[model samples]
Target: MAVGGGLSCIKYLMFAFNFLFWLAGTGVLAVALWLRFDKRTEGLFQASDAPSTFLTGVYILIVAGALMMVVGFLGCCGAIKESPCLLGLFFIFLLIIFAAEVAAGIWGLSNKDKIVQDVKQFYTQTYNNYLQTKQPALKETLRLIQFGLQCCGTTGTIFDGAADTCPKKEGLDAFITTSCPAAIDEMFDSKMHIIGGVGIGIGVIMIFGMIFSMMLCCAVKKGRNII
Candidate 1:
């Protein structure tokens, strides 16, 4: 009976962790879908603009959300089972994700200026290449690329609540369908399947870890009661 009680406590912890992971995962999926649909249908890419900072933010969120879900699920299982193995596995995965997030955030913040400059340089070089080739079709494609980039930055600012200096031209929506909609559509689309794939893999490991951890903990509790 004492052993069972300890195991029950472990189960409660697992359930809590699982709930949090699911909530965070759902949030990520919703935002990714919104970005893909909201902007793509509005001709946000026909004007030869750059990709927006919001898109970058979206990508960052996706990656972080995925890691969080993985770790959270593992933690839930570890706590419920009272198993040392599950607990250790959860801890290890969490540590890895925490370190990665820190590194990526730091690097991105530190190299913001450099990244901006590099993107500008690459944009120029690509345009010049199209010019030399003298391909009308390629030139048109380049125009779309430029528009995507511009919009990426401008949209980011607009969303940030800065003064809206960006031009909102009429027929822009029609132009997207007429000019090229697919290109823009792909930009915001999140690879949920990919995220799911990752989730599945991590989930398997988490399950085993949790089981081991919970069992170990319960056993310890029982032993203490006996003593």
Candidate 2:
């Protein structure tokens, strides 16, 4: 009876953990979509002349979210069914996710400065292209970013023959107080900490999931042996 109760407790705990994991995955998916579609960040995606580090990061988030949802579902099913095979599969998935998360976290941390610099350069080129081509979509995106961040050109100062968004002097309707590079750095820095914390938190949760899944698998095997 005691063993049965312990197993039941573990099963419920696993379910609870997996449910939260699933929710976290959903949140990640939402954030990734937002980043991909947000007007202010659209310039990062439209830059054809530069490497798309920001877009690549968004893609990674999307992939991670999808994997998390799958793993979470598998874990829930495995725990509910008390199936050794499913639990083993869940363990394998968790291992893969764990390794990937670790690698992503390390890469993000190491390339923090580079990512900011790349973004700054990308924004500058995009803005310049917008000036020459006057593409409505690019113009609108640049305007949104400049006004939203209260930032001007890449250096935060109006360039010679700058666009309407980066006027030489402050106007009644338009004025940029910050630079794009500073704004981008500030925005990404805050987001990076939040993302890093969430990643670490998820990684820790995955470890627990793995441990519990293995334990449950062993229990299921032991029961079969006794039978």
Candidate 3:
């Protein structure tokens, strides 16, 4: 397997790339888990009526991140072992993940408005329930939402202000503030380009990975045939 030539160089390069990719996948999985289960946010998701949009996205991250780690491990092992069979499997897994990512991007774009509306509804319900019950959990949830979005109540007016949770703005800014719903929509709109850029970058990386796997697999087979 060690054909000891340029193919060896490709093998090491593949191993290094996949090692870094594995680390990145681990980091992504960690962050997603934290967001989903942190003490402050866990209550929000555990409720019977939790919104599916946000929760669904987190679950997707968890699954994708885990898959990435597995694929990366397989890639690293395949490269080091120069096993054509392992490399073939790695290429298949990578292709599947890439396809899934592309599909997710398209689905997200097509349903952006629906996603925003679903989140807004959840926020509105939480805001109202807090006003009536004044429960600490609800209050903290609202605080997290307001602070995270850097937004205030629905109207941006005194009504539903829930000032304690909203970010502090003084003078003119207090009167003219962004509402949570608007902030949510604006966040999605503003980040569209960034999301797209990231997706394209990942796509290019996957394409290169697939190409490398196939190249290495072919070279390994050729070396075996020669020997």
Candidate 4:
């Protein structure tokens, strides 16, 4: 009786966890879509010379969200049915995702400096092109960024050859002289902690899901053995 009760509790817990996991997956999908289509980020994608790195990251988020939804459904059904096969499959899926997340976290942390340098290079090159060609899209992007960040060029100085976005007229209260590179860095850096916190939170939730799935799988196996 005690064993049955314990197993019942676990099953319900697993169901609850899977439901939350599914919601998290949906949230990820929503955020990814927003990033892809948001007006603020449109310029990043519209620029003729935009880097594939950013685009690839967005795509990965979309794929991960989709996979999460699939796995979450599988887990919920497996727990409810107490099916060993489904539970085992769920375990495998989660293990793969956990491993991949760990690997990505390690790689990103180790290459932080390189990533920053690459982004800076991309921005500088793109800005130079905007200056020379004055493409409408790039121009609008620059204006948006400058106005949003209250920044000017890469160095935020007229010496870098100010665009119309840069404040040329003196005594303008809305003017900003800080360079875009520094502004960009500050903008992104401020969010790093929030990003890190969310990543860790998701990782912890995944770990719990793995543990629940494995436990339920064992419970199911034991029940079969007794029969």
Give the least accurate 10-residue stretch of model 3, judged by summed lDDT.
Answer: 39-48
Q: By descending TM-score, how would the candidates be arranged?
A: 2, 4, 3, 1
Q: Compare the candidates by lDDT and give the number of the best one.
A: 3
RMSD of 3: 3.2
Q: What are the runs in model 3 whose C-alpha is more than 4 Å off? A: 23-48, 132-137, 159-161, 190-193
Residue-level lDDT tens digits of model 3 in 15-46: 87788667756755775687587653454475
Q: What ordering of candidates by lDDT runs from best to worst?
A: 3, 2, 4, 1
RMSD of each: 10.6, 3.0, 3.2, 3.1
lDDT on C-alpha atoms for all candidate structures? 0.49, 0.77, 0.78, 0.73
Clashing pairs in 3: none
Give the better candidate number (1 or 2) by lDDT: 2
- Residue runs of model 2 more than 4 Å from their true location after superposition: 1-3, 129-138, 158-160, 166-176
Window of ten residues with lowest summed lDDT in model 2: 167-176
Tens digits of per-residue lDDT for model 2, 1-227:
11265877888888888888888888778778777777657556664554467778889999989889988998899888888889898889889988988998888888888888887877777788876888877676677677656678766556444557553454633443577878888888777777877787888888888888887778778777887
The candidate scoring highest on TM-score is 2
TM-score of each: 0.47, 0.87, 0.82, 0.84
For residue 49, model 2's alpha carbon misses the true position, in angstroms, by 3.3
Q: After superposition, which runs of candidate 4 have C-alpha atoms over 4 Å from their true positions?
A: 1-3, 38-40, 147-150, 157-162, 166-173
What pairs collide in candidate 2?
156-179
Q: Which ten residues in a row have the lowest lDDT in candidate 1?
A: 154-163
